[model samples]
Target: MRNIYFVRHSIQDLSVQDDASAPLTKAGNVLAKELTRLFINKSITAIYSSPYARAFQTVLPTAEKLDLIIDTHADLRERQAIWRLDWQEHLANLWQDFELKADGEESFADVERRIVPAFQQIYDDTEGDIIITGHGTALSVLFHHLTHGQFTFSDWQNMNMPDVYIGHFSDENVLVGLEKIAR
Candidate 1:
C-alpha cells in the first residue's frame, strides 16, 4: 500500500510580510520536531515540500532523521494572497466560487490548476510512503480534490498548524482510505 502524508506547515512568523521568506515560529519549530514521532516506522521514502521557508522548515526534522533531501516544488506553495489571522470569511468567500479571483489574488481555480498536476506528477512517479509539506489553503485545496469534494472549507478552517493527513492508495489512481493524523 502507498501512503501519502500531507503535512501542513506549523505556525509561521506573520511579522514577515513575505510569505516565501517567512519562517516558522520558535514554538512551531518545537512542534515541527514533534512531527517526527508520527512518521517513525512508517517507511517514508521521500520528502517533498513547498519551496516556501515555513513549509520547508516544517518537514526538516523528518528529512534529517531519514537522511533524505527535501524536494521543493513551487506549485506546493500557498494560495497567492495576503491572508490575515481574521480572514476566515475571506477564505469562505473564495471557496464559494472556485473561479473568483480577488484583487491581487489567484482564484481557487488557478491554484488548483498548478497544484493538482504537480501532485499528480508526484503521485505517479513516487514510490513508497511520501511526505508532502505545504500550506493550509493549498493542501486543503488538494485534499478537497482528492476526496471528491468531501473535504470542505469547514474542514480547512478547523485544520491545525502542523497538521498531518494520511491517504492510502490501495490501487493505482485511486485513494482507498483517508484520515487526519490526530495527536
Candidate 2:
C-alpha cells in the first residue's frame, strides 16, 4: 500500500516569537533524534518538510538516516497570520470557521489553497512511503481533507508535539486506512 506519514513537529520553543524561526526545545531535540525509528525498514522514497526551522529540525534525523534530502515547501509552513495571544481560543474559532479572520489574518481556506496543491504535487511525484514533516495546524488541515472530515480540531488538539499518522492510499488517491503512530 502507498503510505504517507504526516508528521507534526515536536515541541517548539514557545519563547521564540516568529513561528518560522523557532527551533526545537531541548526535549524536542531529543524526541526528534528518535524520529528515524518510525521509518525503519519502510521504503521512504522522499522526505518533505516545511522550511520552518522547527519543522526542518524535527525531520533532519530521519532524512539523514534514510540518506534523503529534505524538500522544503513554503506552502507547508504554518498559517502565517496575526492571531490573538490566546491561541487556543483563536484556533478553536478557526476550526469552527475556516474562513473566519480579521485584518491581516490568513484564513484556513487560504492555507488550503496552497497546501492541497502542494500535497498533490508531492503525492504525484513520489512513490513508496512518503514523509511530510510540518506544523500542527498545517498537517491537521491536510489530514482532515484526506480523511474526509474524520481528522478534526479535536484530533489536532490532542496531537503530540511529535505526532505521526500513517494513511494508506489507493492508486486512485482514496484513503483506505488511517492510524496514528504512537510510540
Candidate 3:
C-alpha cells in the first residue's frame, strides 16, 4: 500500500488581499509548526504544494524539517470562485452537480479534470509517503474523487484550516482507506 497525505493550508492573513500571494497569519505560523509534528517518523518522500503562499507556507515547516524539496502545481490551487454572489452556495451546488459553473468560476468537473491527474501523477511517480499542501475546495474535490464519493459536502464544510487527510492506495490506484489526521 502507498500513503499520501493532503494538508490544507493554515489560516490566511486576509489583510494581504492577494489570493495567490497572501501569506499565513501569525497563528497560522504556529499551526505550521504543529503541522511538522505529524510527519515525525513517516519518512515522507516528497512535499508538493499549491503555488499560493499560504499553502506553501503551511507545509514549509515539514519540508524544512525533513530536508525535502517542495514542488508546486498550478492545478492544486483553490477552486476559482470569482462569481459575484453567494459563492459558498454556488460551490455547494457545483459540487452536487459537477457541471455547474459561474461565468468566471472553475466548475467541479473542470477542477477534477485538472487536479485528479496531477494527484495521480504525483502518487505514481513517487515512492513512500507523500505530503501535499493544497486549498480547501480543491482538496475537497480531489478527496471526493480519491475516495470515490465516500466523503461529502458536509465533510468539506467541516474541514478545518490546516487539516490533514491521509489516504492508503493500492498498486492500481484504488483507495483502500482514508483517514483524517486530527490537527
Query: lDDT per model, in order?
Result: 0.90, 0.88, 0.90
lDDT of 1 at 157: 83
Candidate 3: list runs displaced more than 4 Å: 83-85
Clashing residue pair totals per candidate (backbone < 3 A): 0, 0, 0
In the range 3-74, model 1's lDDT, one tens digit per residue, is 899899999999998889999999999999999999877899899999999999999999998889999998
Quote each prediction's TM-score.
0.96, 0.95, 0.96
TM-score of 3: 0.96
Could you give candidate 3's per-residue lDDT for residues 1-183 as a string of tens digits? 889998999999999868999999999999999988889888899999999999999999999999999999898998887846776787678778998887877888999999999998888788888999999889989988877898889899989988999999888878999889888
Local accuracy of candidate 2 as per-residue lDDT tens digits, 29-121? 999988889897899989999999999999998999999999998899998778568888888888888899777878888888889999999
Q: Candidate 2: give its CA RMSD in angstroms.
A: 1.2
Shift in Å, residue 165, candidate 3: 0.6
- For model 1, the superposed segments whose C-alpha errors exceed 4 Å read 83-86
Instruction: Please give the lDDT score at residue 88 for candidate 1.
Output: 76
